[model samples]
Target chain A: MKTVLIFEPLDFSAKVIATLTEHGFEVSLNKDNISIREALEKYSLIYMRLGVKIDAKLLDECNSIKCRFILIPATGIDHVDEQACYKHQIQIISFKNKKELLKDIRATAELTMALTLTLLRNIIPAIESTKSGIWNRDLFRGRDIFGKKVGIIGYGRLGSIVSNYFHTFGAIVQVYEKNAVELPSHFERASSINDIFLNNEIITLHVDYQESNIQLINSSNLMLATKQPVFINTSRGQLVNEADLLVALENKVIGGAAIDVVNEELGFNPKNPLVAYANHHSNLIITPHIGGCTIDSSHKTEEIITNELLDLIKNEV
Target chain B: MKTVLIFEPLDFSAKVIATLTEHGFEVSLNKDNISIREALEKYSLIYMRLGVKIDAKLLDECNSIKCRFILIPATGIDHVDEQACYKHQIQIISFKNKKELLKDIRATAELTMALTLTLLRNIIPAIESTKSGIWNRDLFRGRDIFGKKVGIIGYGRLGSIVSNYFHTFGAIVQVYEKNAVELPSHFERASSINDIFLNNEIITLHVDYQESNIQLINSSNLMLATKQPVFINTSRGQLVNEADLLVALENKVIGGAAIDVVNEELGFNPKNPLVAYANHHSNLIITPHIGGCTIDSSHKTEEIITNELLDLIKNEV
Candidate 1:
């Protein structure tokens, strides 16, 4: 029987170990502290999460052994050393390859809507105040999202989903995607980025993090906003200049902000100016990067990976 | 010119006050401290909110004077002495009479959605943790509302609207309305209230507060909730017994709760069990009675009242 090794605890309805065992593979679970040399010697197939860095040293150890495949139960493979894996002739299988698997990637979009509604209604402060034994209803007089103009900065999967959500809630949706495609009839396309900023009362970014996209919402673009819009960034923290965002929030150039991702997220120091501002200002809501971390989404991803691994093993046999 | 006494400081756009003034009415704005007797003697028309109670004594004072109309810029007239108003032959005009006026009452429905999303995502604790310098993403793994079964307790204006919102977000909506009307094509009408509690993962109450409906969600009905649903009450708090709710939450009979209104809200003591529990438990979210207090909703209501009052004056002339 082929030995399969799982590197982390997975929470899914499907019994992965039992399924692999029934398929004639001996499965072993390992803690993070397990030696790479020992793991490679025992298991030919490996499953791990994206947070487990598959660096060159680990790749070298795997290449010297019978390791044939590395199954990642995630969309991103940035943590893995791709060149080393290719050189070692180890096949990489990820959720990204299974186009049909991510049909319902609504978790991120749901979270974006959650954050948007939280900011719109002053829910965080309201909940905080309520918990603190104060029932100050007057202090939390909110604005309705209905009839508000919402600008979606990207027209990708998540952005389109979020746009649909806002539109369903009676907000007029405007879109600005550089790689233009046919849009739904209800969504009005903005001619330029400035058009979105100038026309909309709420703006949310869902663009991919690229070198050119860094600091996309700087002082110049923010200044063009005719309406002091509540801004949301669930895409990437680098997409907006943190300093500029803080200044805009402080100066009341923008109505408010909800930031899920931040630049240097792993090294997010409490002393950061944005973090400091978020601590004090009720207008700003800072959530740790958890847009796509819902239990449903994670379970779906795990199921897809498990099915794919079973099929791969069957084909190999 | 007929005198009009505005009872409170209204923050509506300049248009509402301007339109009222243009209609040949002498308008005088007064603080809440203004004497009712003094105001009735000076003005023929009066504008005030529901908070400014018009009891029998105040009604008698108005009856002895030239006050012709009591214009309440609200939906409810429970604050006014209806018998006295009728005895004095004074017309009581409210937003309810003007059907076209409240074509879109979106604020309460919007707040309901906000509270629902906040609870599902554990946003309160997430924000609190982030602000307290703890970046714990693992602690805040949420569940998607998409594809969840949601039970709506009432199918009236607000309940219907909230049902539509949940349906749009991909939740299967089950409704239980006592005044059983023909439901929309999409919603599944539950055979009984217990059916709603038994099957759905989420339950929201939008029922009117009445004598018989008090303690609707007591221990008996709460035990019927097999799904351990998150309960939301944006309606009057007296509908659910506070002690029962706290017990259910503590015993995990319900997954969570987001309460906007509470019994004895005017005399909300911090020592209340529900309030005390909310302060300790992240599962419970409490908001002051600000469900319909959005700036947009207030402005819309004000505009509708102002227009109706103007038409009433014109008709009288």
Candidate 2:
């Protein structure tokens, strides 16, 4: 049988599994963390998520293996070393270029809004207060997003969606895109990143992960937060300097923050300053990287990727 | 000097206080829970919020008092006995008739959407998990609001705002308004309240409180929730039957619920079953009545009502 290895446990529907089996494929799911390189040697196709990092060394070790395709059912392929995949001639299939498939995938954007509201409204501690048998609304009065100045770092797929959401809620949205992208009529284009931080009350990051843009939000830009904006990041953990974020929260340079990604998220350390700060502070809310961890998005993406993969395999045979 | 008593503690700006004092008004803020009837006997104008329950008995006892006007810095007149006010010829000054002023008060609506996303995204527990040094995303996979059926009860001010918000998030919105109200072209009007519960994946209440509509969401209508919708109530505590709601949550008749209001919110008893259930289970999320508690809303409403009361007093003098 044609061998397939799902390197990460994902919610694949029964129908998708049945279809793959009928097509002469033996599907094996990785229940426990195992060596991906060894599995790649035995399996011709490997289905993976963000859990495993496909670095240059791993791809080099599996270069001579039967692994021909690395199937990633997500938009960002930053987890996979694209340069190394090209060197090994292994095909990396992802939803990065598939705009049609990703148009309906709003999990990440939804979480961005969720984090913003949760942070702004003090929903976390408020819920905790109510759960602890206290009902003091005075203690947890929240900031209004309505008529507030919200700054968007990147006007890409997720950014645009979030900008629209904030705008609908009566917020004045300002965009700061590095590469020139057409903005909606209502959105104000920030002159510079510093201007964005200086003017807005809420700042969110949604930039695609790139080496050039690493540590994009640091002390330099964060220092210009004159309005003390609530910083939100749902993109990648490497995008912001967590150390600088800790300083900003401590000094009240920014109002607060809600983050879904951490720098060392794969094997997240509790020792991270931001995580530790979030444990005690009401300003910082840290969710377990659940931006795209929705059942609806998972099922749809899995089914679509599976069908597409089957078609490609059929064509090759 | 004209006497005025602020019966409830509110965030009145320094400018407002200056303005009141400059206009020959002797303002006294109630520092303790003194009897309103005694205060009424001394002060001609009394400012209040929802903390005090104004009934016919209290109004009758204070009927012969010098108090001629009740200044409520809120929209809801349900807390005050409107009939008694009319019977005693005491004018009620509130935001109920100020559509122009209320157009910008989006705090409650924002909170409604906040609660919905918080519940649907499993944000509270996810944050707690991350705080406790757990990074398991699988444990908190959320449901998407996108492409889900959302049923909105009441298409009034707050209800319509929430409907528009849900629709913007890609939800198919179905509104159930008891009285005839014009809905947007995109929104579907439900045949009955029962039909709304049966069809939608998420249900939110925004209806006004009325004696006729007490316990509107009981076991009778909750039984029809075939989709097991997440119940959201930001409207009023009295609109839902607490006993029936507890039973629905326990039986899984409804998916989960996030409520900002409880029936016994005034001096709230934490012994309530919903509060007790929320302490243990992740399904029920209870927030203190923070729906209208926003800095922006509070400031704007206070200023508006204070100024309006001053204008009335000026005209009467």
Candidate 3:
């Protein structure tokens, strides 16, 4: 009988356990086991999502696992220790994880659009004034999103989703990718990253956090972006050079930004220039990485995870 | 041939003039002439939109061409001088101005969705923080929109359009209307307005500002809303009671409000409780009426006016 240990609590984990348990596989759930010491006791395989760290400190105890396989339940490889797995001669398996991906991407894209719209409409200032009992139309007057151009990087799921919405709203949405990807008929694909830089009034990043992609939106790249395209990233924070983003925002190189993922997921320092700027300026929007965390999507995610684990254990899929 | 004297500046006034002029009717363009006396002396008909007052002063000066017709190109009749027209016996002719109603309704619906999304994702505060060059996710952490029941009042074009978008985003949408309306297959109409008030997490008003509907949302009505329902309105300001809305907002009868229409349209004053409350709280968001003022929509407004006038002149419709 095969055994699998999930290092983190996944959505729908109960169903996944049921699928596995009824199938005669020994399954150990690890909701509290974030560290490597707890991981060392795993069986033949492992499954995990965000928040679990698979780093060198924990890899030292890998010999005790007697596990043959390692699994990453999502696309990003940030938390997984690939080199450690290779050295341990463990087979690695990864799923596209569409349920999580779709939810996260959709949530992120939707939030981005919301941010852009609110920013354009001066919704915050208006809210602030209304609270203050002030009705300064001058402070809250806003533009609409009917004819603006939006540049989207990483024409994957989230980017594509945002594209569909913006296009529907009559925004000219352009997307870019290192590899060719088919977009919905309405979206315009830009061949070069530079083209997205030149033409878009708003630039959103949805690409994976490849090293090459990391710091990709640093000083020079942001400088290339014409007149402050509202920079957005829901994928990974490192894809943009936060330091450079700060300078650009400070200097008005980009018009504004709406970011869901932050480079420092640990905590934000108000002392930082960007952090300080976000305090006073009316254009920059920063959210902790919460794109896929909507209660609606989260409920769906829980269901998918449970079913996937159940099927795998039961040999149903 | 009958003629209508429309006021200064509309989107397609030129086209309207061309439509009416080329059809063998003498043209009395208002851009070149602002004198009501001159207009009354020349033209027999007048087209109306917003911004121009048609009070007793303007209606008193008609002589040359028997007060033939007052054609309102827009839906709302609030701008028309009804008493004056009635006294002078100027025949008012208007089919339901479907184009203006639908276009404005659609735009308003879109704005409501946009506002709702922004509020849920904390986009306004985030944007303001970002633009000021700060990153404060703590202050702006927000909830997702899924699982929330959205109550739509007056399910006409605006209400219906917004409901469709909300449904797509995975919200449970309910509607309340005085007239039995045929909704798309996916929607379920609440048996009564209280059904929406009791069940929904959000309340959006699309009711027009007629005498009967004024103050429809008074103290008791506002009290009917449950679970801190966020209130949104793009319809006329009079549909909601100012004092009742303020009390509801202050006492947490509803969660918060996002309004584009206010009882005080000229502006909010120090004496207004809404203004006073808004200055101290962050939940209320107020916008100057610009939901349908997007560039694209504005162009469409002009097109509608121009095309309709041309059709009438050419007797094409």
Candidate 4:
């Protein structure tokens, strides 16, 4: 039987290894040595997170090991060499089913709403301001989220849930989806990508991690947007061209942005380009890409993966 | 016929002022000077904001000012000298009708939901983090409002609307009204204040401004509730005792707080006790007392006051 391996460091789901093992398949977790290329010959199936890059060299080793499947245990497959996988005849599966993540998606959508209101009302600044014992209510004469135009790109799970908030708040909800898929009965769909840019006062991205959706919000889309829209990217970092996003904020193409993902090659720090832009632009709000986070979501994600692995080992295998 | 003189500082509504002018009342707005004593003798009805002090001296000057009806623009009458008004036989006519601020209350309740969701999911922080390009997705994990327990301390107009958000989020909603007043059908009213404090995961205060509801959430109340409930106050400033609240955060008596009001003599500033507390504690959030501050709410408030003043001038006279 083929062996399976998980190299990604995670603080959850202990049952995955046990389930795969029950199927009479040899299984081992690369906790001590996570360098995939060096250890590729040992496993037929491999799963890992974004930071651990799997390139052509790893694919060659996997072929030597007669590997049949490469599972990237995340939503985005930016770190994996897809062409290499194809050449090696490795079947690839990335991202959980959308229905599986609906609860978490709703959480992420709700988080975006919270952040938007906090930013608009200057709640953080007000909190910071009051820490020093100064009363500045007038300074925090913040605007309400009600009746604002909110544009959502990638009308998938997260985008759809966010639209509900906008609608409830009396905001005009506009959605941008490349597929032109029929949306929920309640939502107002954006006719085209340009339409999302043209009509929305605030824009949020919720597209999944297919190749087409990657880098979807580039300079052209920013230019196409009508009144400078407030951009948000909780979907994935690769979906937005960070440099262009920064430029958009700097050059005033968009009003501001609230980001949850960015290019990992850029690194996460105070001096990062987007961070630099956010600091200067009071309008921009940044977060450490926590849309998929939340203790409950993490636990649930692990449970789902483990259960799936168990089912495959117990019956499908 | 009584020549009722009206001294209001801001611009009078065309319709409202017209009603007074067309009737027997003579209206004068203080555009040049802000002398309370001088303005008192010239006006029978005094319209004022937080800045104006309707005291004994002013009331004595307006002794001949029949009815001595003082119309306060906002709900809270902390600024109004009630003792002086009573001694001088001033009939304080605030809003006996909650209908006057129904629009505003609804707006505020929706706003509170927006802010609460934002804070709970680290949405604002995520925005700031993302804007800065940090993309620390792991750091910004947030919880959804769904399946949570939300408690409303005072189930008046604002509380009823807020409770509705919890219901929409699929959360269990409970309310505690000191007077045992029944709330909306959706709301599950607590038989006692202890029940709310005992079971609720998130507690919001919406009691009216009066002696009965003052300092309602003291050390004892905080002790009875869940160890950590998302706390919010959009009612009176003095309702939650500041010292007790500060201690609650310090001891982790509650999970977090989102404040719209505070007990302070100096007014709101960035460097207040609550602000100081928020900085030290990750879960504390403080917004200026602006629950009813949406564009929709402001416009509604304008209409309500306009209609009320106009009706009083024309119909009463």
- Candidate 4 wrong stretches, greater than 4 Å: A1-51, A57-74, A82-105, A176-186, A218-229, A241-253, A263-272, B1-73, B82-96, B104-107, B123-135, B178-187, B265-275
Tens-digit per-residue lDDT, B62-119, candidate 2: 6477888888877767878888877877788998767567878999999998998898
Which scores better on lDDT, 1 or 2? 2
What are the runs in model 3 whose C-alpha is more than 4 Å off?
A1-105, A136-139, A218-229, A242-254, A267-271, A276-280, A299-317, B1-82, B85-107, B124-141, B219-221, B246-253, B279-281, B299-317
Q: Please, what are the lDDT tens digits per residue for candidate 3 over residues B81-152?
A: 777778877655442446334443245666787777765665655555555545444455455565578888
Worst 10 residues of 2 chain B by lDDT: B8-17
**lDDT per residue as tens, model 2, A95-198:** 88785777788999999999998988889888989988898887888889999999999987889999999999999999999887889899999988898999
TM-score of 2: 0.95
Per-residue CA lDDT of model 1 for A81-109, tens digit only, reads: 77877787777888654545776867778
Tens-digit lDDT track of model 3 for A1-317: 88778765444346656766776778877666546455655577776555556666677755475766666545576767778877766655554535343454255667767767766665666666555555554444445555678888887667766776676665788888787666777788898777888888877787877777877778877878775677777778878888888888788888877677767654445465655666677787566565655544544454555555555545744
Candidate DockQ scores, in order: 0.66, 0.79, 0.25, 0.42
* lDDT of residue A22 for candidate 4: 69
Candidate 4, lDDT over the whole model: 0.67
Task: Give the candidates in order of TM-score, highest first.
Answer: 2, 1, 4, 3
lDDT of 1 by residue, B134-230 (tens): 6667688888888899999988778888998898888999999989589998999988778888999999998876568888878778777887899
Please report, in order, the local distance difference test score of every candidate based on alpha carbons.
0.80, 0.87, 0.67, 0.67
Best by TM-score: 2
The C-alpha stretches of model 2 lying farther than 4 A from their native spots are A31-34, A59-64, A86-89, A97-100, A314-317, B31-38, B59-64, B86-89, B97-100, B314-317
| lDDT accuracy of residue B80 in candidate 4 | 71
The digit string of per-residue lDDT tens for model 4 on B192-266 reads 767887898878887887787789888888877664777777776788888888888778777777777777734
